[model samples]
Target: MQFSADTMFPGDLFEAATRFAADTLAAGDRANAWQQAVAMGWPALLVDEARGGAGGTLADLGAVIEGCARHPVGLPLVRRCAQAPALLMAAGSAGADDTLRALCAGQVDLDVVDAPALTVTALADGGVRLDGVLEGVDAALPFTHVLVSAGALLLLVPQDALPAPTARFVGIDGAQIADRVLSGLLLPASAVLQRGEAASSAAAIAQDLAIFATTLDMAATLGATIEQCIAYLSTRVQFGVALATFQVLRHKVVEMYVDYESASVLLARLVADTVVTGRLAARDVALCKLYLNELARRGAEASIQLHGGMGLTAELPAGRLARRLLCAGFAQGDRLTQLARLATEPTAARL
Candidate 1:
C-alpha cells in the first residue's frame, strides 16, 4: 500500500519519507512501520550481508536518518540499524546469529540503555545485576523484550522484567519519558552481551553514533521547519504587503540558513569519518552534535519569531520544531557536556 499525506512533500526521496512519516508513522502504525523499515533494509543497513544484513555502511544509514529527520518519524531505525550491529561486532558476536537475523527481519527491536543514573553489580552466578535509576528512558518500552545497557555490559531483558517506574513524564514532543528504579533486577551470564573492554568499547562507539544520528535528525527537522517558515512568510501579508518583503524577517531566515548549513556540513564530515575509518571519531561527533543542538534551538526561536503568534501552538510546525529543539539538545549530551568530553579526549586541540 502506498503511503500518502495532505502536506507538500520536499520531493524526490524525501517525499517518500514525508509520506511514510506522516501517513504511516504519525498515524501510529508503529509496529507495521517497524516491519516496513526492516523490509526496506533499514535495520540491515550497517550489518554485513553474511550476517543477514545489508552490509551497506554508516553513510547509508546517515542518509536514511536524514530522511527520517526531514519528516520527524518516530521509528527506532537507528537502534536497530547502526547501534545494534556496531555493538554486536564490538562484542564479538555478529556471526549469522538468530538475533541478528531476527533484527534484520524486523522481529525485534534492541535499545541501548545509556541512562545517566545507573549502577551495576556482579551476580554470584556469573551474571550481573542492575540497580539505581534510569531517567528519560523512551525505549525498552511496553509489550516487547529489548536489549538494554547495564553499566559496561549489555543485557537482553524482557519488558515485563522490570518493576513499575517511580516517575513518569511526557516528553516535550509527546514522547514517553520515565524514571525507573531498577533494583534487584538480575540477569544470567547469557544475558550479558559484552563485558570489560568490549562492553566499554561497544558503548562508547554506539553511544557516539546514536548521539550523532539524533543530532543530525534534529538538524534535518530544522531544515524542514525553515522551509515551512519561509513558505509561510512569503504568503503571509502584513500592512497590505507580503511579510517576506520585510528586510528584518529576510535577515532572520538567512541567519537560520547559515546555521543549518554549518551544522549539516559538520555532521556529514563526522559521518564520513566514521564510515571510512570505522572508528568512533568521538570528538568530531560531539562537536557536530553540540553545534546542531545549538542551531536547532536558535533556528527554532527564529522560525517561531518569524511565524508570528500561531507558532506557539501545535497546529503549526514551528511549535513542534521548537519542542524538538528544546529536547534534542539535552537528550544527548548538552553543549557543556560535549565540551568537557572534548577536553578529556587525548590530544584534544584545534577547537
Candidate 2:
C-alpha cells in the first residue's frame, strides 16, 4: 500500500507513545511504559491482516519507532515489529496468529532471538534438539515465548525451558541486559518450524529482518541526534557569543541536518521498495542500512563533540543516545559486513 506523507506521520500513534512515556516517566515505571507501547499494538501493526496484524506497512512501523525513540520508551520496537513479522512470513506459519493478537491486545510479551548461534534458540534444529546461547535477545526476560532461528529453521520456545541468571548489565541505551545459558535444551517435534535448509532460511530471514530492524534504528537515531544537535546549537555558548552565531558551528549543524534528512529519506524509500517487491531487495536495503546507520553514528559523534563536556555526562541524554545508536548501528550487521555481502552478491553488483 502506498503511504502518503501525511498518513505516514502516524500522528495518533506518536501522541499515544509520547503520553505513555511521559506518564511512565512521572510514575517511575519506565519498563511498564515500554511494555505497553509494544504489547498494546505495535507488533500487530506490522503483521499481515490474515495473520492478525493491523496490516500496517513498514513505513507505519518506522513512524511508530521514530516517535518512540523521541521519548524514553525502552522496548525494542523495531526488533519486535519488523523481525517477528518477517520471521512468521518466512516460516509460512499461522502459529504466531494467536501470539500476535495477544501482543496487540496487551495480553502477552513478544520476543525473538536473531542469534544464529543459539542452539535451543527459536527455529534452531528445526524444533529438534535445541542448543546454543543467543546474544541480544531483545526483551527476552519478560517474554513468554521466543522465536529462535539458526539458518532456515525457526523454532518457538517457551521461556521456562531456558537457563536464567540474575545478573544485569546496562546496555548502551540504558536498557537492562541479561545473560542466558542454554545447555542441551530440548524441544518437542511439534515445536519446530519445519522447513528446508533450516540454516539458509534462518540466515536469509535474519538478514532481511536485520535490514528492516536496523534501518528503523538508524531512523530513530537520526531523529534523536537531530533533536540533540538543534538543542545544543541553540543553547550552548562559545567564545564571546552563542555557538549558533559561529559560522563553522552553523555549518556543522547543517551537515548533521543533511545527514539526518538523507537517512530519513532512505528509510522511507527502503520500506516502500520492500513492501512493493516481496523478494529480497538485498542490495538496496543493505546500501540504505549501511549508509543511514553510519551516518547516524557519525552524527552522534559530531553532536557529542559539539556539545562538549555536557554531552558526555549521563545527565545529558546525547551521549547515552549516541552510544545506543552506535550499538544499534553495529547490532544486526556492521557496515563492513553489509558492504561485503553486497559486493559478493552478483545480482547486487549488477544493480
lDDT per model vs. reference: 0.69, 0.65
Q: Write the per-residue lDDT of candidate 1 for residues 173-239, one digit (tens) a residue.
A: 7666566688878877777766776667667777777777777677777777777878888788999
Best by lDDT: 1
Backbone clash pairs in model 1 (N, Cα, C under 3 Å; residues 3+ apart or in different chains), count: 0
What is candidate 2's CA lDDT for residue 228? 72
**Cα lDDT tens digits for candidate 2, 267-338:** 666667766764456676677777866787787788788888777776666776777777777766788988
lDDT of 1: 0.69
Candidate 2 — which residues are off by over 4 angstroms? 1-10, 21-28, 94-108, 118-127, 138-141, 166-169, 277-280, 346-351
Task: Give the TM-scores of the predictions, in the order they appear.
Answer: 0.86, 0.84
Give me the displacement of residue 44 in model 2, in angstroms. 0.7
The Cα RMSD of model 1 versus the native structure comes to: 4.7
